[model samples]
Target: NYFSKNPVTGKKVDWYTDFYYPLLNQWAERVRMVTSPDKLIFVEPVPNEFCPTSLAEHQPANMVFAPHWYDLNALFAKAFGDFTVNVQGLSRGMFPLKTFYWGHKGARENYTLQIRNIVEKAHDSLGERPVLLGECGVPMDMNKGEAFETGDFKWQARMMDALITALEQSLIGFTLWNYNPANDDERGDDWNGENFSWFSRGRALPPSLLYYEQDAPSLDNGGRILQSIVRPYAAKTAGIPIHFQYEMNTGTFTYTWVNSTPNPASQTYLKGEKSVFKPPRTGHPALMSLETELFLPSQLAHGRTVIVKGLDPGDKHRYDESRQTLFIVCQDASLDKVHSIVVSLDPPLAPAFAVNDFWGDFGGTITSILVAIAAIVTYFFLL
Candidate 1:
């Protein structure tokens, strides 16, 4: 009866009556016969007007209207809960063609709004069945340049955003549009002539860098190896030195000793397992004692510490670095220990040590004389 009046394949018949039911039957039958361990079928009613209009016009012969997707989700609990729902297909047309097929804003908006309206209808019809934007992407290659918005990368991003946004506000899963890479895929092309799919032997261009840069998922590389560390020296005290030790999980780090009090000589262990040490650099509290060192292979796997030592008064220190792993030792005036140790993989500084700053101060004869005199006095007195 239905076919005599409406030819199944004819352009005159509504696609929903002529094609939709046949396709739905095939899908349901396959799901039933495949009979895999975890395979099953759960059908629901979703209405859309723009597509063939068979289901849209008939209204499933039993269902009524309801709220949009987001409002339906609110029933589960506030804040649009998560869910997975199946979307049939675009109301009309195929992949690349669909993107450009609609000529006016009203048509495009109407199509998009139909999807939004269906989300609400489904929520109301089935009482919110885990809404997901099952499918709403397109396969774009280099050929259909005219079909795309100026064939520009930004257009792809915008299209993706629009398609994604059209789904339920609380959508969970989103399967991209038809992806058949074997059809002569071209990164910038629009069709199958040059591999119409995304995958290819050469570099595959994505919709756009801006899309991933803004919305793609990201991961943390374990928050840099080290956090923060400090080492202080005694101000007016007699022989008290300070040291520190840091515990870290990353591969590298920087060691620093903030020596407000001055020391004649302060030693930082270039390499050490545990305990204390004293070296030759000294400065005030604000001045820091720093050492940037890489961990030996044996020491890299687990945890370790570095020691800082105050050979004599007048030593201020701090240290830092941006490496995979590090162990630092600085003398602490507060502790009786000879040195302090911090283990990490953080950078000691931002600008890093410039050659000009590291060696520029070693000026002339006056500097040499001062160093020599200071060395002599420190050796005689501290010894």
Candidate 2:
């Protein structure tokens, strides 16, 4: 609509020939005189000066750049510069923020270009330090005054994909705006109902959607789903590092180590010495270190290694949902056996297979059984 203009008919052609060309030539000349070929310089403030707590909380990621608030920009004009703090809006939520479904309207494209320019200038001024365009997303819903639009789901995602692609070159990372979908209203209508969450209200996650939440396990009790172990059969040599990670589908469990025999098989079997380990509470991954000597059983003549894992019980609903896998690099040739150690990787509680294979096998078996029963019942009734 904004692109519309009158058709070039007889009178209009004359007007264009006279007025438009001369005006365009004059504007071009003026632009050339004012604008330089050199790029604009943009300086970014040091990261922590804006929000001390947030900077402390955000973990290091390979591909992302987090930005400070608008006011903090002046502090970091020079590299490694210290800043005077001006704190605002730091504590608990002051009531709730209104959800405005301001749809993308006039000048949206122009606005995007303006933001792009700012990012470019900032990167040029700061010298490249993983310069990413952070915080530039419209809500799914908006108020009347806000120039944002709520389009179909596919379209929004597609548009975001395009924007992210454009940003990829200069930006090392991107942080999507506030993830908390709760705008303080149960109905969601107060905030246009659309800007809240990736999830829809009411419908609990279906079984089919479980996979996305399963892969990353939480070290703490909010716990992750117990991902199934598709391949049960595993082999381990002695002692490189016994790698094991757990998922708390049914809350967290304490890990205990036992050694049954003296050989490889015995290493898998926690037969005699019982040792339980309660892993520390952590949101981020923490390396575990437990040092103790093991008793070697003579029958197999090999030594035994031990490991333990534990999770808190409070996080049951989501934590108790999955399985854990233990892997070892085989440090000791004398000890080859690795079993599901209340903490071992071998001899998992359920059968273990590759993720894809496990899914296929589980689905196929269920389908086949149902079909067989249906056919048998039909034949009997017909007879």
Candidate 3:
């Protein structure tokens, strides 16, 4: 006799509306009673929704955002296609969200903006609480399982690239959707044929097609999706992240994060800064002795290809081809001051040219004397 849906506030009698909501409050209360200040309890708004404005207030003080992200195009279409591709599904016909959200902006562009917006929602609504991309990955069977048969995961790689670029640009952490050996292109994830697993011996191509492209014993088995997903990240970040990017064609990865602050909250929270007093040269949330582990396609970084500027004395770097990664360490860097770190695979070099180099080693003086004599002879003859 108590079933109801509010037309104004739109509250419903479902568990999510009543039981779960109260349960969350109860959990927060329990945390306040038992948990310490340092430990965190992560929470989400819903499957794909951003954290609501009230979420932060309702949770414990040490909670963080744990929103899930998915390339909506792939999720809706169940295929490796772009956002421009029309989304096809029953829910899409009655509701035009898929079409409208994906509107003319093309796949890569749309996803970047969309993912960025999602990240910003957490920042703006949640107030700098660390956001983790809880679950994200495109299904391998997209584009009608073309990659599985052709053994070319270019599509998967490109799609994953879009996803990774968005996450890194946002400087958020993510745990890819899954790592299920059971995902056959036929059975998928087994719950709803949702096969998003990145590793599978049954699906593994020959050693040649293996990610990292290394000869392996029976233990190691995964393909391009795994390769694309298991790339490098700042294992340790020195400061708040500003931005980072990866150039696909050049296989270049660039990362920037504020590692330190001479003053508190230099990177953000400016509204309250005027109230706080500080000393001069109390530079930004400053950073020094920054270190990053960068991934590359090949082993060694190209000659002089690793560059990190703005450190007090510049950064020290080394490349490991076996691991396909470059490790960089910087002693001093600043957020108020701009700094950059770049690692790339450069192109072949050009030959150097010098005006006198051609004859320098082969008797340059003799050649000059011969030239002078020829000039004198010509002058006399002409005269």
Candidate 4:
């Protein structure tokens, strides 16, 4: 039996019941006393644990369930393959036999299921409080540092894409593990041989630069797996966001949200009283004036077309190329109505060259060169 001496009562007590639980509650209470009540308190789960269900009894009003998740198989193996294990299930003693998933599609589905489970558990125990994925990222030094030697981070990009895609499918917010300027190819992050930093000082020539020479890294560049990291996302939504997905191969981004608001009497509405969208019956002009803003990366938005559906006739959309933002106003009279916006490349070419090449040229012909130059000039003029 787990036992501990209660410092306050000078008596022996059950470790988890009389000691650990009280200690955690007291610590949370103490933290709540000092910090502003309006500020969010991100309570981290115990290491290796999935959810903090123990705190359900004394959960603070501003408490947020923040948990860190990682693909243990990939993290430890330092190589991404077609197979993945159910590490979380094994940790929880759910099954004696470890579950395995095969193929890239299966692995990705497994990853997304893991995140979905975490979010669902938090919701079940915490009652609709925000669940923020505290940390999620892939190690850059995969395949025994193959990318470092060849400067081909395509594998790293794929791994990162898988991780982020899981997060996106779960419809949760996350903070990437790290961005360290001091990271290099040799020692990595300078801690326990761990190398997860997005940016690294060690310069390696990528395949794009193999044909050209450059003395310094471009101002827009520095990351290891940027193709997966630098992506389009909805910065702010006037209505409740339902779902969003980005196709890395096709340069297509789709976002959907419902034109609804929380009950006016709800705490969420009171917290953001000034910014909350009022119903049209309330005679609030801002009711139908709210606009959703989406951040579109230059590489994706340069020549893409924006299509918005389920919007009122007067409601419109605009693209600010300078800011790389797509703004859409949806004035649907029905609060239950859902609106969607899709941004896709104009030509809708094959994924292979459409996403990677700017001018969409594979041959080294003079005509291709001229087309590339004209595309560059047009891109600049639009900018």
TM-score of each: 0.29, 0.24, 0.67, 0.73
Per-residue accuracy of model 1 over 283-323 as CA lDDT, tens digit each: 33432333323332322332333333433354343332222
User: What TM-score does candidate 1 get on C-alpha atoms?
Assistant: 0.29
- RMSD per prediction, one decimal? 28.1, 24.3, 15.2, 14.4
How high is the CA lDDT of each candidate model? 0.33, 0.30, 0.59, 0.69
Best by lDDT: 4
Global Cα lDDT for candidate 3: 0.59
Count of clashing pairs, candidate 3: 12
After superposition, the stretches of candidate 2 with alpha carbons farther than 4 Å from their true spots are 1-115, 142-151, 181-196, 203-383
Ranking by TM-score: 4, 3, 1, 2
Instruction: For residues 79-191, write the lDDT of model 2, one tens digit per residue.
Output: 11111112122222332232111122111232233334444444333322344444544333323312123223332332233333323322223554434423322343244
Each candidate's clash count: 81, 59, 12, 0
**Residue pairs with backbone atoms closer than 3 Å in model 4 (clashes):** none
Error of 4 at 161 (Å): 0.8
Instruction: Pick the winner on TM-score between candidates 1 and 3.
Output: 3
Q: In candidate 3, how many Å is residue 5 off? A: 4.1
Superposed Cα deviation of residue 249, candidate 1 (Å) = 33
Model 1 RMSD to the real structure?
28.1
